[model samples]
Target chain A: MESIQNLLIGFNDIFSVYNMIIIFLGSMFGTIVGALPGLGPSAGIALLIPLTFGMPVGSALSLLVGAYMGTMYGGRITAILINTPGDAPAIMTAQDGYPLMLQGKGGLALGISAFSSFIGGIFGLIVLVFGAPIVSKVAINFGPPEYFMLMVLGLSTITLLAGKSMSKAVMMALVGFALGMVGSDYVSGFVRFDFTPELIEGVDFVAIIIGLYGISEVFLNIENLVHLKMGKPSFKVKEFIPSISDIKKITMPTLRGSLIGTLIGILPGAGGTIATFLSYATEKKIAKNPEKFGNGAIEGLAAPEAANNASVPGALIPLITLGIPGSGGTAIMLGALIMYGLRPGPLLMVESGRLVWLMIAGLIIANVFLLFSNILLIPVFINIIRMIQKYLSPIVTVLCILGAYSLNYGMFNIWIVLIFGVLGYFMKKFDYPSGPLILSVVLAPLTENYFRQSIMLSRGSFSIFLTRPVSLGIILLLITIFAFSFIKKGRNSKNQDYSEE
Target chain B: MKLMERIFIIGMMIFSGLVIYEGIKLPIKSEYTIGPGFLPIVIGIGIFISSISCIVQSVYKYKKLDTDTKFISKEGATRLGIFIAVLTGALLLNEIFGLLISMVVFMIVILRYVEKYSWFVSIRVAIISNIIFYLIFEIWLRVPLPGINL
Candidate 1:
């Protein structure tokens, strides 16, 4: 009942003329930006953070939230119409989506994705409204010990085996963690291993993220540059509705995807990639018709698309309550909040209850906007992509560089953008996920600072983690996940041998 | 990738050792006592452990795999090194030439030379981007542009 009242206030606050206009503008702007290749919510919110500086905290957050949700949803349009994915999460969509477009089901795929995204987004927000206050209260009890343990759990969860082995992922995570520790010591104010003054301020989060995910992807793309030329794929859709069978096939996958995305989103540092991957893998393992998975299946398209958008709201849960960003997009959202003079954390909900509720309401409104805009603009989006590659390619490149540069007022960041663009290219060529590395880099400071503080508080006693029930539970959960993974791997290896035989 | 990983691990270990050595200069009476060196030592130990683990894993993988297996191809590795070099160059130039001039030059040089954009295309992009930055930061946001000439 209390939650219901809070939600009613949220709706009132969000539906105001000023807030609605901001949401619309933000959604439109986000769609355009996300339609461009390589720019995701990170770039969108970062580019617009300055614009929110003078606005009231709720209004400012409402605008940014609108943009964030809009971009994730909008990225799908370009991904489906063109063979190229608009962002990393959209990559999976392109796999089955492009094939569908080639076969002339592009409009239907876009319609399904857009509708599913709305459902997923709404489901995530419902969870947010009902569960947020309780979650925030629980999060408030987290001291450094609990925070550190939780980070360790998050890191370990992401470190589970890739295709070949867990060791590789662990290795990559350790490298990222080490790189994260390069700058200032939060406790003693002593700089360790910072050779230059620039580094003393530490490696900028924006630069490293852009470097690993953005720049690395560019480099990876360059390898295929000679072979690849972009002209929009042509597809015409007479109907946009999913048939009864198609709806039945996709419904369970979408729900499962939403659940996966929402759960992962709540866990700090776990982002859409993990949620989407887990959802896809889970669907594959359970599907009655599993053979269609990598071969233009609608379920494949729906699950990941639903999961990706769902994760946005999921990611917001941690950011609002715990002041922890679950993903890159959320991190950028946090930066926007700080720019608006609203620090996100425990006190935020109680201190500015109406504002928090209003933001949640704004997210719901944005989802509605996303659904209407995506469906109405599908044909236009596909038609516009018909422009020749020579023009579209340069425009996208410019946008990517522009979006990267706009994050901080530094021109050096542009260089970081290009550098990481190339690095991203190479990482993609290899099987290593730029996602985990980028995620690790993003979460490193939080993990390290908390771990350091906890140790200091305990005076070097490892028993503090055990003494705290929440921390103890988290640590136990971490062990259980690893243990489960090990058992599953053994079973998988047996199945692998059987398949081979 | 193996070479790079090994180099990174070794370098980190050496760096960690140096940090620990410096921390030795800070007086500490008890192991449990919080001192300036305590956090540094914890970090140093973590690095050492990870570095050793990385080396062991690299060796373990080497033994497990056939000689034909390639962890990271040479071309990919070289491109990665070049990328890092460009980033380092950008940071250095930012400090040396300040923000605006360095940025314009950085944009032109990298887009044109490294990325192989035509001079005309590069110049157009560089100029337009520079002006946009000027408007957004200096004009709209009121963030003072750093003196570029100095």
Candidate 2:
């Protein structure tokens, strides 16, 4: 009864004119930003954070959250229309979305993707609304040891993702840890890496975020300038809505993707990129004819796109519960919350249940609008893709710069964005996963500070990490993952040697 | 790539060694007491181990590969270097000119030069972006933007 009443209240809050406008504007801007390759939710929200400072916290969060989810949906447009993925998560979408376009089913593909996104988003929203309180309560039992173990478990995901080169991922994680050290010590007030006073506040989250996502992507776009060509396809108005057949094909994949994405979202540090990729791979593996997956399969196009949208709300779970951002985008959201003077963790739910409920409620409303907008806007969005990529690329590059600068009202951050832009390009070139580095950067300070604090409190006794049952469980889980990965790597190498022989 | 790997590893070793040295200088309360330096020292050691592993892996991989390619294709390396240089340039300019001027100038220059947009387009973008920025950031949020005192 209370849940229903809360939902009703949430609807009332969302129906207000100002809140509706915020959601619309956020979705519109987010879609445009996400449709452009390279600028994902992290950069978009970071860039927009400073701009949303004066508004009521709920309104500001509505705008940003709408944008975040909008980008998740928006990336599919470019992925389907062009072979270019708008962001990393969309890479999986491009695998089949581009193929669908080739088959001249771009409109149908877009339709199914939009519907799948709606379904998946609703699923994630329900999870957020119903599951957030329980998760927050569970987090209340977490001490420093639990946090330390959680970080270790999160770090282990790098090994899971590193494929054959787990060592490089570990190395990158260490580099990220070092980068996290650039600011002052939380305990003794000693500055570690502040060679200049500019770094005394430590590496600005927005700066590093822009550097990685915005600048690196700009360089890549510029490098790929010659390959900037568009393919043409006429959309059928009737096919803008998915057929029953299309829905049947997408249902299983979308369900599977949403479940995986939601789970990944709840876990700290694994963002949409991993969730989407994992979902796509899982769908392909489970499909009867795997060869059809990258060749315009409806399931292929729907799975990752749905998962990506699902993961946005999923990631918010930990952010709201433990005050730990599960991914870089969530980290930006966390930073925004802090900037707005709102503490976002277990206490946030306890002290400000209304705002939490309102935000979750706004997401459901936004998802409905997103579905409605995506269905109607397919043809219009496709028309924009017909514009010259050369011109669009320059505009995107400009947007990246402005976006980076908008954070912190400083150009220094813009520079950081540029640096990370270049570094990201090289990291890509070197086959190093940028996701681990990002997760490390987001979690490193918290992990280090908590670890140090716990150790200091325990008088340097390391046993506290083992003595706490929750922390011990997480640590054991990390060890199990490491052992499993080690065995897997050994088997893979053996297979490689056998192939050579 | 091998040469780049070597340089990176050597740089890491030097950087981590310096950190470890600095970390050791912080005052310790007791043998059991975790000082301000403990975490840094641990981090330094972790860096050293990771760098060593990276160097080893690079060497092993280098031996297995055909050494035909120049250490990272020149075009790729140059593009990456230029990207880094531009970013570093932006940061330096921010310190000198303040945030807004440096950012607007950086965006305009990057769009015009590297991206090769026309001067008219670049300047127009700069002006329009600056105005929107002023409205959103200065007027709405009340954030104090750097490099725009005048």
Candidate 3:
């Protein structure tokens, strides 16, 4: 089959000794970074991107994908050992994982989650392998009008889900649009916001990314530097391998969570956080003893952990097939794809099919590698976390500064990082979701070009969007979402009024 | 918190105005198609309208805003302020002392003074981290990392 052939092509690319080593090392390093309290997949990739500047595209992508997968796997450590979740998706893990730790099943909890994470990852990968190609095939036929509508739907969905205040989300997105306007316009060849010579090239969203996710996180972490109260460190190999009964318990929940994660991940903006929450809720509702849900329940722990890892691959589907990122982490990966000089879209497979396949091959290898590495290296990871607790903020700050400076071998991006670091801190403190803003910046140029081209094709008629069947369908979906949100808002306000009375 | 919120809103409004002013100077249309200005102008107006709506929402939301809600404790805020200040100072130092030296100094200052790590521990971490950075970025990556300028 073509799928097997494509995978073979990928394995051929990944088999080189140098490429294999990079994935192995990147995966281990990513786990350490992700296990740190504040760093996530985005920060792990952004800070390490400078190292890949001179490598071959295949190797570079392999390393990045390895790190991305490692972060997903590593998120469980802090959740199980300490009550602190490494990132948002791991929040549900802590609800039961830490409780299980209290009940002296910490080693078993880690083991169960690791196996479940691997299964979830493999399930998502299967879907990605078959799903992306099929989606790409259908997307290849889409015209500019449909592309424009798809982009609007993507941005609108992210904005709506970004924060509690829809208005603030829109404001942030508009700010992103403004930022995206900085460089030369491709269609008209006019520069709108060319205040600086650097602005002539446009705001480097990557620099903004490093600033937002990397440096801003350091700032926040330093504010409340709580030393993690680690549990017992020693775990024998037997303690890590789940028993048959344990496997039987987690099998159905992990599968159900994987299914929910993949489906939600395919929908833009509905990333791992939502998937994990939904999975945890579903498990609780269907549990034989709901009273046991959060008090050391292995099903409660396994489901969200599976969902968390599954959503990583699920988020990649849109990025690979449609050039639309499904989440904040994938948004950065989209930027990386562009940085590698490969265009992402329906034609991505057609043009750079070999490279795409190689990345996929690398992801499969990374997923497997992380499972064993995470289990064996558990003690080492905990020790490292405890050792570096004091000097973490300073070390991370240095890495962030060095990373920004290395972007173009200049000080300009360092300044951008600093300024945006401040702004990003404020945005976080104010509860304004940065996801919509970042997505807006990444998609702005694409959205603008598609809209302009669609208008030109239809002789300046706005009705072109509605005339196309696919575009009309997207429009209807958007309308339904808008109506639903409004009704939900009304009901929420009424409920609040009743509570007050 | 209220003061910071007010400043951000006014700043955003001003930024929106500047965007609109610059956008209108560019041609809004090409040959039967939208031009560069089309998107910018639309975005500027969107930001402006969204800012107004945000103002209205904040007025209602902040009315009963928990006055006692501490955004950050005094100690936490002070530490954050010092962190940013030191980080800014280090970037300036990079122009003079080079990346490695400046960052090492930054590390020392934060560890010894801010977090109160002893001199022995502070210098050990600073030197070790800088060496690793130098080996990776300078030697392996061939990044042309700035050396000691002074």
lDDT of 3: 0.85
lDDT of 3 by residue, B6-120 (tens): 6788788999998998889899888878877777788889999998988887778789776736667898888888888887898888878888898998899889887888999
Q: Write the per-residue lDDT of candidate 3 for residues A24-110, one digit (tens) a residue.
A: 988987887777777888888887787888899999999999999888877789988888888778889989998998887888888
Distance from true position, residue A60, model 3, in Å?
Answer: 1.7
Model 3: pairs clashing at backbone N, Cα or C within 3 Å = none
Comparing candidate 1 with candidate 2, which one achieves the higher lDDT? 2
lDDT by residue for model 1 over A1-501, one digit each (tens)?
Answer: 888899899898777788888898788767765766766777666555555644677777888888988888877777776677777678878777778877878878887888778878887888888788988877776688887776676566554424455544554555455556567766666665566666676555555565554445344433323222334534344356678888898898899888888888787666777777787888888888889877778898888888888888888887788676656677556645654556567667887788889888899898998888777766655444343122332333433444455555566556656655654554454344444454566567777667667877898887888998888888888888879878989999899889979
Q: Interface RMSD of the predictions, in order shown?
A: 5.6, 3.7, 1.6
Ranking by TM-score: 3, 2, 1
Q: Which stretches of candidate 3 lie over 4 Å from their true place?
A: B66-68
Q: Best by lDDT, which number?
A: 3
Best-performing candidate as measured by TM-score: 3
Superposed model 1: Cα runs more than 4 Å off: A8-64, A82-96, A138-144, A160-189, A198-201, A222-257, A263-271, A274-300, A322-348, A352-355, A379-462, A489-501, B1-5, B18-33, B60-134, B147-150
Candidates sorted on lDDT, descending: 3, 2, 1
Q: Output per-candidate TM-scores for chain A, rounded to 2 decimals.
A: 0.77, 0.86, 0.96
Q: List the lowest-lDDT window of 10 residues for candidate 2 chain A.
A: A388-397
